[model samples]
Target: MSQSRSRVIKVHANDNVAIVVEQGGLAEGTTLDDGLVLTGAIPQGHKVALTDIRVDDPIVRYGEVIGTAVVAISRGEHVDETKVRLPQAPTLSDLPLAIRPVPEVEALEGYTFEGFRNPDGSVGTKNVLGITTSVQCVAGTVDYVVQRIKRELLPRYPNVDDVVGLNHTYGCGVAINAPAAIVPIRTLKNIALNPNFGDEVMVIGLGCEKLQPSTLLDDRPVKIYENTEAADPDANVLSLQDESFQGFGEMVEGIMAMAERHLERLNRRQRETCPASELVVGMQCGGSDAFSGVTANPAVGFATDLIVRAGGSVMFSEVTEVRDAIHLLTPRAVDESVGKALIREMEWYDRYLEQGQADRSANPSPGNKRGGLSNVVEKALGSVIKSGNSPIVDVIGPGERVRKRGLTFAATPASDFVCGTLQAAAGMNLQVFTTGRGTPYGLPMIPVIKVSTNSTLGQRWHDIIDLDAGRIASGEATIEDIGWELFHMILDVASGRKQVAADKLGIHNDLVLFNPAPIT
Candidate 1:
């Protein structure tokens, strides 16, 4: 018999199981708080049954039913996917609509950050010139032009933070007229209008692409134009196939000329004092483990509440991750309309998955299971906590701009890259991403603050992680401590006084549009 002391973490008072906190695992016959003994060896992060459960009984965590037992589970035995069956999805029609009252939050006063004030009353943490492209065909040429702008022109603009080509795989070889095509097209347009870009819209286009530059910016606002007849005097367009440019040299020159003008405008902007309310923060999780809900996520939730209290905006996305626990959200909607809107997005996604012949089970990847999440139900319960207890002020579809402040549920795919890009399109000026297995995910246009879910991952990837939320799991810090730290960190990043790990290492993932349309 082994004499090792092991401890378990119970998430809720009603939970019949608790997580094994011991490193590696606990062997059989291990003694517990009440003289109960482990019936078998349980792996770290895995659940240990605290009471006998009959077949078909509900498995509870976070005070909610995560799943139902598929087999009889006895005390001290391990509980995992093999022993549980996922429950059915919540029905949309009968979901409570805005039953919960809005949280009474005090206006946070005297909180300020140094930021670049935009002409549209927005604020930017960084002053970067974004070069938007109409289609994928011109990406190479646009990239080349960006390089030249950086080497030959960027140095002259000392105030400009950076110049990046907002290049993406869209605009060609697709059904541009299709109803769903509007999603990606609108996404590109909105990304160009992101606050960090400072309202300077410059478009590079392949003259033959289905998405013409004119169509992309048909009625959008702009800041740079050479003619009075232009719809947007502030926006400039460069068509590679224009008759004025006969050769590659002339094409490059034309792009360079337009770039110089924008760079000059961007360089003239300076950081000014802005309120915390000007901040729009995006919250997400990836590479999640069992400790995710127990540690990092709850910390993020606390921070989300702090942001809401400060009168700032916070967006929590990943539709599939929220689908199962959506019942927990409808009642929190600000009103009946907001609750219905939430249902519409969920129902739409259900049809989307059915069309693809998949379901929520397709979620909870192998890594999640290995990390002790049995199915989508468990993952979702953990995922939704990042939104905290804030009321759902609004719900927006993919790529749609956020209209209301407070907590907004921006519907998006769970894929890290795609969700990050969509959040940017939705006007996220900063991002907080928590991970367990770890991902070096970041966006060039915004600061991404990485939070680790466990101390082991935090220490191993110390250089890349901005905050070690693992302290909550290790008992070194309280959730409130990490939450306050994160809140302060957001202000520091917004003020440009600190740089996130992703930005320091120059690790940026490409923009991946959530195009649900077919390519014809």
Candidate 2:
């Protein structure tokens, strides 16, 4: 391992590239290993040329090509917007897929967590029953319904647990089914299929929308609540009888009576030994510092590998950041074609950025920049440590669940709330998030175990964060030790132990959807 310097770096060993850790401060012509030297003072986290190369030559990092050289390059020059290029991925069947010899480790015996196993064979990490709407127009009605249910029912029905609101934007304005609306579509899937939900949800709908409640049922059973009811002329009843139409008091009473019976039934189910294959771990990182890749990311990567060995899966998003870290992922590609498909996703999104659908600046937010990331490429290079070099199983749009196991998958659309929220909806029992700065966010039905990259953020915002990885950078702890600790914590939480931070602060992010979607 190389010692940390104040500025200037090349991340990969084989690469003909280097990064300007501290931008614009070089005394020109300073020498580095392999005859590399400063062409000029490059910006921090920006790359510098290592050797002369022609256009389309691969620029390697983490020992894989993130992109090809856009233009002819010379030795010891800055390699970024001016020099580096993005590449396209090939078809999935053509991609590489490898079945490595599974590691021989004793399975943790009787690793049962107290949770609900839905009829569809899904395990829920939390005991939450919620009313989720398809669009924003219906959000208020669901909110109203929750308020009514809580005020009237929770007071007496102890087993009913928590009544949550799962509503968001993105059912409309799509190309009829682009991966854009898939996130919410799957969210609806899990909520209905999840055993944690009561016998029947008081389904709410606007009656006349593209995404109707009935369509979501497909084969699932549900108790529909229509906001657009017809008139009852004989009895002189009002036309609309949705919970929204009823007085808040009456609505709550009705829901309470219905919930009392089901809550008890749900409680009778107990935890059992299910293989880790039953688990879907959602991986994320934010508020990062330089220590992210070295400490927290690699640490989670270990847990990721452990889960995969147990026959489970891991999910990573924010594709832009994944681009910079693509090197670590290439070998995981099942084959060369899979590797090509993975890179293609990166290239397509890069072109999308040029059209302004997304902004690269958003990659390293103002908060991230303050945390020591100067730009998106720098932040991206560090953000993807959690995937842990597993094979690229498949590519999914937002809100889609992981049907394939043994490695990571690329999910479209990015935003912590939406991404994390969708992961839970897609059926992750728990989510593991690492932050160098801090974030107080948890998906509904999944207990988030927040790990801070640094101790300062952990201590300062202890109320929201659950663990501290700061020691990784401080040289006080190793990833193996921290990863073991994290696995234990995950077990505890799965067994119904509340991550203190989430318990204390009451943080829950629900119904966050994105892309080509209506406000509702």
Candidate 3:
């Protein structure tokens, strides 16, 4: 790989294109480290052809075919999706399985963080009581009650962190009993059990909603069923539509009463020293540009290896984003079963998209195109790097809990909010989000560490981005250096010794559930 102040980075020996790293891009006739002169103006974070290319030629980057050129192109000309046609998606059948031996990762023991121990033997990075809502009908009332709790009750609970409304847009006016309903049902259940909530689960419901409060809490570790004949009569739940509730005041009072009980239980909890093995982190990227693969993501990949070596779990999702490179990942599976599982997910998503009369080509949003990503294939090459080189130990469906350690492929949509929600359901206590175009996205229940892919975005959104991964592209820091920095930063954030940018600014996006079922 060659990079210099001329600001062009050649990623691999076989790559026919390189990324322009200059802040404002280079003008025509600019010289690169290899003495290759630009034939025309090339925008920063965009690709430049390293050699002359003819029609139908492969445009290679990161040692893989990103796309095919549609027209003849001379050396040093700007190469983008306009000139490149999307290639065929990789076939899933007969993929290589468990062929790549797992590299020996030196065990990095003795790394610990301060966290709350739960009754289920899981560790929590944050201590708080989560009040879950069973239906959208109760969201407004629940939000009002949550604010009251923060003002009137939270002050008295010294040890507990702030309470969050486990609010989402599901539970009513849908195919509640359809086969696909299982996804949303399990997702909601798992989210209520997220490690950060400390198991003090409470529920707010409207009596007439299809998703009853009892349905959400029945037989769970922390049950709070509504007062109904089918539910535990003594089980405590706040139902706004209950016959006993005559007015808004009465409803809010009931919710506040329930909030105090859960808060009191949460207040007694304290942080204890725990090993890094207890950490379950979610890795994702949004608003991606070409530099994503070249800088931030590669650095995140290195950190992913560190986390895996430390015996922690890291989940990388976004099915559509990785579909094009599905064959590349199956070989890294820990065994044949895992490899088959990976293929099962890819095939399932393919069918799902087909049912909707669409395909992976719909990816690479306008922002991605403007940022220089040519197609889903190019994006997939960069997207998979965040998983590092770790063996794929397990693969789970959307909203399912991830049980094994190492890198797990949790299948979900590529939308930032939906993917984060599914990861949260999978029990991710901390999240790392990388971006080149920049987004102030975050979650209320977890700490989101944002990394910028280029220096321009880093300097422009200094307050929002927690890490400047762009340093790798600028030649100021190595990928390993940034990786170690992020690893330690996770420890500090998890231990409560420091706060990520999102937490400091109190920025959070709503949990948007993924429901493939039809609306009633």
lDDT of 1: 0.88
Comparing 1 with 3 on TM-score, the higher-scoring candidate is 3
Query: TM-score winner among the candidates?
Result: 3
**lDDT for each residue of candidate 2 in 1-520, tens digit (9 for 90 to 100):** 2323544444567866655433233456866655566766554444567778788988765455656777887786766554554454333333333434334555444444565566667666656666555556667656776776667666665544577766876444444355545546666765554445633344445555667666666665444432223321111011124545566454444444444444545555556655556677788876665457656787898788777766776777777677655655665676665566676777667766777776655566666655545455556667776877555676665556566776656465557776776566555767888887677777655677889876667678877878887665545678887887887777677667655467557777665654533334
lDDT of 3 by residue, 1-520 (tens): 6785698988999999989999999999998877889988988889999999899999999999998999998898999789998999988877899899989879989999999889998888888778889998888888898899999999999998888998988989989999889899889989998999988778888878898877777576444444333454334577777776668887787777777877888898899999999999999999999999988899899999999999999999999999988878999999999999999999888988898999777999999988889899999999999999999999999999989988999999999999999999999989999999999999988988999999999999999999999999888999999999999999999999988888899898999999988889
Best by lDDT: 3
Rank all candidate structures by their TM-score, best first, as comma-separated numbers.
3, 1, 2
Better candidate number, 1 or 2, judged by TM-score: 1
Ranking by lDDT: 3, 1, 2
Model 1 per-residue lDDT tens digits across residues 126-226:
99989999899999998898899889999999998888998888998999998888789888888887899998889888879989887768687433333
Model 2: weakest 10-residue lDDT segment is 231-240
lDDT of the candidates, in the order given: 0.88, 0.61, 0.89
TM-score of 2: 0.74
Which residue segments of model 1 deviate by more than 4 Å? 1-5, 221-235
Could you tell me every candidate's TM-score relative to the true structure?
0.95, 0.74, 0.97
Clashes of each: 4, 25, 0
What CA RMSD would you report for each candidate?
3.2, 6.4, 2.1
